[model samples]
Target: MKRNNWLSLLEGKYRVEIISLCVIIVIWGLLADFVVKELYKLPGPISVFYAFYKVREVIPLDIAVSLLHFSMGLAAGAVVGITIGGLMGWFRVIDRAIDPLIEIVRAIPPIAWIPFAIMWLKLTHYSAGFIVFLGAVFPILVNTYAGFRGVDKVYIDAAKVLGCDKGKDLIKYVAIPHSIPYTAAGTRIAIGIGWMCVVAAEMLGASNAGLGYRLWSRFYLLHMMDRLVAYMIIIGLIALIMDRIFRYFVEGKILKWKKGTVAV
Candidate 1:
């Protein structure tokens, strides 16, 4: 029975993932060994495995610093984006007046702000966080605004009929809940972009320590291919972990009501 259960488990999608991953690793190893032919240029999976051991001592600190930077920026972006986006969406005049400016600013890439961040914040963790903020804020703001704008007329009318006539009351009772999904989607997107920005922010010398700093300075610049690949893998893994956590809390718990409407 135990063997049968194990075979059944191996018949699931998890099995496919495991098989595909093994195939990919084999292909990567072959490419590194036959095509690259240089450890400094393209180290294989086995090489990256050993490299992880070398970085074990510093990996925790690097992860913490990167997370700190990401957290500061994500928190600030959520607050500012949601607040401004809410006001703009709730009031047409505010939207018209501020939207053009926002559009113009949004056209500028997050990397472009690196120079200003360095100058203004002066190469501290704050500067790194600021770059992350630039990456995260606009997606959240745009999505939140869309959510508020998309609140149905019928919902508003019904709320008003229920004696929730005040702007604050309508917003609190109807609009906020309606906008939660949009805001959640934007936050997920921002988390991805923000994580990417963390690497860029640290890579460009915005901070002295972090995954990006080590990935660039200690590995890439030093031509340590195995270590660099390890860092890249670590970054991807961390992002996946964070995304799962967000989905669990936001979609699984807070938005559990949506399960009926969604495929889940």
Candidate 2:
């Protein structure tokens, strides 16, 4: 009975959200059929669908550019941020010295760094990657720092008594597991920030590619409204997919020890 109740809650909550989405879709379809049909010929879902279906042919180059930058920037940010964060967290003096500068840099909006990125990297892929790094790095660093700091002292004490203070074994047996939640949270946040910065990062300089560049290009062209909307939807869906993947990986593995929510 207890197991059944938990299963029911998960299904119920998931179904409710799906139903809400369906309701919104139905409302949109109706509005498109009646009001929009009579009005200024705004392309509805059909147009959006068609645009998406045909997008590869319409803007292959631009799509490739956007994906390239997004992937590259995210990868770079994750590597650099985790390395720095782990180091700082593992060491007290280094954390104190670097933490202040990290905070200051993090406080500056990523978009504001566009000028510097462009100037430093000169309208290259690295510029976009740098922008993405700026957006994603802070969340990763902060989460790692928190997690490392939050590790129970008792575990460290035990590790010490067990003759575990020498080499790789110490970090593997002690520090890594203790900070899994922090690392997971930081990775989740970094993914979100990287996605959010995609458009702005791509917008940093002149080129004939990327979602942001394409949006600007299309606005100037004043054609293919549905294509623009399709791009927006695609970006949103990608983010959603990434978030779902993250949750599954984190909760199912890294955070399995956490108590599951109790259903009423």
Candidate 3:
């Protein structure tokens, strides 16, 4: 019964996603492959896939390049983000003082900092990772801080009566568990931003290989259709994987007792 309920929850003609994908392919085939090729001249999805297959015969450099930069930026963001956010959320004075500075930078688009990234880190993966970091960091920080700050006062009061009165023990035993949901929510959002930044960063002369690099490189060579489709597929796949990872780990165990809501 539980399994059936779970399946019903998710099964909203989800298989239509494949149908929608094919419909798009057919539309592109007629317009781009048949009509557009007759004019400016370019290969379609089939030929592009064939090229991708041939390219794989040598080595898959692009995948590795993008993943490396993404991992670095994501790790840096996750570590620093959670720590600082948690601290700021925990301490009222610190939150009030530093929040304005965080907000100022947060308003700027991640790509706007590309020129500075190049000047500082040069045209390298570090620069690319910096862009991704900028994209990811704020969401994580905000979510974590919110989570940290939002812990129930009642829980704290109860803990105090239970001899968890010390500051360190209060935070360790009471606050941390209470804020897990917020932390997980923040993490989920941060990863989405990180993936978006990877493409922009890679295109800013930071990498020779990566989905972003390929998207730009392919377009200049008149492979617009392939570039468009590839990025769409890559970003979609990455989001899916990221969400699944968060759901499996965070949702399953992090706040099991507080799944529905926190009762007063």
Candidate 4:
């Protein structure tokens, strides 16, 4: 009876998800099989599955390289964004001095920096990471600034009464905690953008070995539509997995206080 109850619970929770996935797969399969008769255009699930086997030897390395680029960029972006954003938030003079420069730089698309990245850093992981950084840094900076700016004056006064007199101390204790949600939101956006930038960076000659590189150079150039589609699907799945993991940690652990609230 207990086992039956558990099974029912699982089914109830996942029924919609399961049904949606099945429906999507069925429609995709039908479209590939009937409407898109040409394999080059749409290769269906079976072809994509087989393509994974065809490129199984290199998928791990590609994934690792892509992740390396992602980590490098994200780490650097987060640090710089938070530091600068904190300073800007804590001081009006700093904000005025830096705001115009930041706005001008961020106006340029990350892809536009590829030439400079390759020229300055060469075809290396750092160059790829640089592109990812451009894609990620702005959102985090903006969101963190907004978060810090939104901190209540009452909280600052209370902190001051509690002996948090120094600017750094007040920011560390009062502002940082209040801004966590905003920072988290920015980081989430950065993750998606950074992931995409890493792929684009790799494809556009930032690195010689990555999912994007292989997908564009090996699969697409050779007209291996199945393999190309397979890589695309893999990229999407990895992004989805990353987002879910981040959400789990942030919502389940870091922001546990928000549970049972509308924000959760």
lDDT of 2 by residue, 50-160 (tens): 878877665677767877877787788778877788778888998989988998898899989888888898878888878888888888877777767776889888988
Residues 1-264, candidate 3, lDDT per residue (tens digit)?
457854564556675676678788788668766678742354566765655555553235666777788888888988888888989999999899889999999999998998898899987789899988888888888988988898888998999999997989988997777777777777777787888888877776666668778767665456565544545566578778877876777756766766643211
lDDT of 1 by residue, 1-264 (tens): 457876786688799887888899999999999998989878999999999998899999999999999999999999999999988889999999999999999999898888889899996889999989989999899999998999999999999999997999999999899888888888999999999999999998888899999999888988988999999999999999998888888877778877632113
Assess each prediction's global lDDT (C-alpha) against the native.
0.91, 0.75, 0.76, 0.89
By how many angstroms RMSD does model 2 differ from the true structure? Answer: 6.2
Model 1 CA lDDT for position 209? 91
lDDT of 3 at 27: 85
Per-model TM-score, in order, reads 0.94, 0.81, 0.82, 0.93
| TM-score result, candidate 4 | 0.93
Preferred candidate (lDDT higher): 1 or 2: 1
lDDT of 1 at 9: 68
- Backbone clash total for model 3 is 0
Error of 4 at 131 (Å): 0.3
On the 0 to 100 scale, the lDDT of residue 29 in model 4 is: 93
